[model samples]
Target: MNNIDGLDSWDGDRDQSVVLSEELRSRLAPPLKIGNFSVHSRVLQAPLSGVTDLVFRRLVRRYAPDSMTYTEMVQASGVHHARSLKKIMDVDPAERPVSIQLFDCRPDFLAEAAEMAVAQEADTIDINMGCPVNKITKNGGGSSLLRDPETAEAIVKTVVDAVHVPVTVKTRIGWDENEITILDFAQRMQDAGAAMITIHARTRSQGYKGAAQWEWIRKVKQQLTIPVIANGDITSIASAVACLEATEADGVMCSRATLGNPFLVGEIDYFLKTGKLKPKPTIAERLICAKEHLQSLYDYKGKRGIYQARKHMTWYAKGFPGSSELRGKLCRVDSVEEGHALIDSALASLA
Candidate 1:
């Protein structure tokens, strides 16, 4: 396969050492069964708040058509009080196998919000028990649930009863280094009727730093009868392979690594299925995607989308010659036209 400019093939010594053994291929070949729902791909696109919006998910879906995608985590209380679907909960009908993620400490509000999500055609309801943001935790939500497993269990049981679709959870290992409570937490979730549990492998104190503790995932996988997805630090096909082999978990979820790189889930999924790496997108192709993303965001959300597109544009402007200067300009773009012009100029330079 052709390699992109400034991009290396997966034939490097490190990647070469990490092969997809026949055992792994056979193990992952079957559809991932979650409750009564079945997902054909072992790879999943994670629910990133403010990042996995409908526009971004559309791009990811274009590549990983069989993989499951998630909506940005919606505040259950916000939806319950407003009695209206939040734009963040929006899922295109065509994006099958997509889950609507909800966060809050109140089981009643979450159950009410889940019914609304099902009305919008959600394939599953995901509880956000693992978010580390203080804003979420301070209000008796997110990772704070780790400290309150009783409430977490109650939330899961209530939502499962309220929704026809399966109820799942995404969470970190524990409150901090001293409290690695995922072993007990994962089992409790299963008993409470969670169809699946995604473990982020980091404590709440670690935030996004430090290496993910995959060993904990192995321990959880051993105990839980439900499918366990390993979620921290899975950035590439190599890391995905290593994590799967080490944890022997059911699947992998792509997180921060997919920022500007929507092709990641598809790349990893292709490798797992075919044992071959798909060619990386060239800098020119990446810039073109950035332009499309900028325009689409503008078309969808207007002025506010332009502001949001700034971070996304900068994310795509990397690794090529003059990329530092290009990122500087892309991050300050005031309009879609300006952003398109900047990417066009960068593409011309690469040519």
Candidate 2:
């Protein structure tokens, strides 16, 4: 198993659905209330930078209709300075329960961004405090806020005051193993009027590597009065159930696992709502989705979308024979027709 489009780990038996504990099921049955806002589903789609664009969101929404979804993180300064809102901040009116996520260390800029987000019909405003990328952290935003609790608190407080919609924060547990400061950080966010907190259960240093230390989520949940969402490693229903039972957080948010698999959140959501498991998409069905995703990306962003679709196309070309070769070809696709042809051929071969 040579990594093959990076889905080697996901090839495990999909038949074994994790049974939710009676206590966990009972606890999560109600709508998750974030201040005045209420979402019918506990499972949420995490905002992935360079992903979670309007097209991607629409695909996820089709399956997980009631789950909350987020836009990619927007720069608060960008939102404040631009004459018009950036395309990344775009949210469809029909996409209910959508939260617009903004990142920056400047409280005033973040406040201004939140106002713009509300005008765009965001259900809530989410502050991004957990992005570990060098560019974001060096700019005094993202997970760096974890190191500066005061600035993070001010951002939340300011945004909450500026917008009628509920304000929330998504952050990592700490900067590293030595600075595991989430216990205090989460408390400060709640006190600063953040309506909900989503904790990515790894330090900034981990950066999607290593196992997510879920114990930190349990600790944060014990202290927060606001809804606490447990994120990180929530790739499947089994992982979602395990995290909920272990941490007892208000909900789970799906991230990297959803890069090519938009059905994951819906599958987990359906399982939580009903005890039965949703069937995994067959290879042909997945390729069909891949084709649709490619076409939509092209429709939205033109050539740039096709270029960006390359990576996404590769992500979808997995879990079947010849998938590795297909990924190799799809990653170099130069046009919508080229991408579609490659996927169609793959499907034909499988058929």
Per-model TM-score, in order, reads 0.96, 0.97
Candidate 2: segments with Cα more than 4 A from true spot: 1-6, 9-17
Residue 288 local lDDT, model 1: 89
Q: In candidate 2, what are the lDDT values of residues 326-346, reduced to their tens digit?
A: 988998999999999999889
User: Which pairs of residues have clashing backbones in candidate 2?
Assistant: none
Question: Tens-digit lDDT track for model 1 on 65-163?
Answer: 999999999999999889898999888899888999999999999999999999999999999999888999999999999999999999999999998
Off by over 4 Å in 1: 1-17
| RMSD versus native structure for model 2 | 1.8
Candidate 2 lDDT:
0.90
